[model samples]
Target: MSRKTALLLLPGLAFLLVGFLAPAVAMLLAPPGESAGTVVSRFTEMLTDPYELRIIGRTVLLALIVTVVCVALGLPIAYLLARSTSRWGGVLLAIAIFPLLLSNVVRTFGWLVVLGANGAIGRALTASGLTDDPPQLLYTPLAIVLGLTQLFLPLAVISCYSAVAQIDPGLDDAARGLGAGRARTFWTVVFPLALPGVVVAATLVFAGSVTAYTTPYLLGGSSQRMLATQLFSYASVSVDWSAAAATALIMTILVFLVSGLSSLAARKAATS
Candidate 1:
């Protein structure tokens, strides 16, 4: 509120404006030499085209699935990690988060190997007589979901872990002493307290999955094109700048929209 405080904030505000806001605004309004109306028309066409609609739907559906899976797995793991009494608790957490240190390409390639026709999964299935032939796994939506889930799970865990860690362990014990069972205590006491973190984790995972390029492109291939791959095609292959910019704008809006809803949900949960 003070002049000195305002001055201190000015540099960070200026940096954000220059680095993020300006580019985002420009990309939304104008794509290189294309006018606003051109990009708007492309965006409208993308919404109406059945093929493009499928791409958008697939992107959202997969993102939602990945987000749900990550939260379902991550929350429990994070809670356990936060409450671990073992001396190796830190080691366990390190193992859980280790995947984040690896490149996305490396992790995705690993999936390709495991999910390929002659890959580990297919081989195992065939050897067990589960199928007469290797079921096609790669270049499918399932493969994209699996790869994106693996890629973003650690982020979910880390986000939830910090939140779970902040809650006093005494609260859990007190709830138990008051005759609440483990599940009840978690739902009533721990979860409500941790909803914000869960929302944050979901938002991050959804955003990453939606905008992710390598895993979707490599695993899904041409058959399973999501918005990111579509954007790449417009930008590079077709050289359609307006369409590319429109796709980028849509992805950005999807992320921001989810984030806004998540924030509102978190606040409502807090108030409730």
Candidate 2:
């Protein structure tokens, strides 16, 4: 390799080795002789636990739902931002980005106020006589999904907007000239071109959701335990560092698998 390239890579390599890799290795290594067996046993126990399995499944499900919702809601805004020539476009983009400036705790509390039993939605339902009482809006999977979606929607928007902005306007014009409608052109031309952004956005949201603790904990409640929460339980509450390491490794594997599949899908979409 070139000397300049090697020099450029040194800082990142050093940081990765010292900051992340060393700690990860320490976590995975149990002690001396018992490390291998202890690691295997911890993984086996975690795998066999029905409660843990449910948590894993629910985490994946919620992450997927959040990704989909973010794409659904963010794409149109992205498209508008990509296509707009007006002042309000920048204003709207700023508005969309405003939520991410707040801390996760602040955001979760905001959702709590909006989604609580006495919140606006519940009050509207009651005032309109839609029901006798406010439904359980907090501490549910839907609540977790909502919080996550709101939290990460900006990622999807920014990614998609950048991708959409890169597409040649001539393609859209050509598609339209060929008698394609607006929806048809987007499905055929714009969306396929923007698949890479969607993939990136989805992977980011998925990884974030998998590792997230605060939003899920506060919004979904103590009952809604994801692998992250479970890992915290093992490491902090139970003081089981080995089990926590195993759980962290497993979650890492899950994220890799999902990200790999997403990349594969994006490649296929690009080619086909």
Question: Candidate 2 residues 1-272, lDDT tens each?
Answer: 99999999999999999999887776766633337578768787878998778988999899989988899888878988888888798898888788778898898888899899999889999999999899889999989998998889988898888889999988999999999999999889999999888888888888988888999988887788888888888888988777887888778888999999999998997788
Which residue runs does candidate 1 get wrong by more than 4 Å?
Answer: none
* Predicted candidate 1, C-alpha RMSD: 1.2
Candidate 2 TM-score versus the reference: 0.93
List clashing residue pairs in candidate 2: none
Candidate 2 weakest lDDT stretch, 10 residues = 28-37
lDDT of 1: 0.95
Off by over 4 Å in 2: 29-36
Error of 2 at 56 (Å): 0.7
Ten-residue region with minimum lDDT total, candidate 1 = 24-33
Please give, for residues 123-218, the per-residue lDDT of candidate 1 as tens digits. Answer: 999999999899999999999999999999999999999999999999999999999999999999999999999999999999999999999999
For residue 97, model 2's alpha carbon misses the true position, in angstroms, by: 2.1
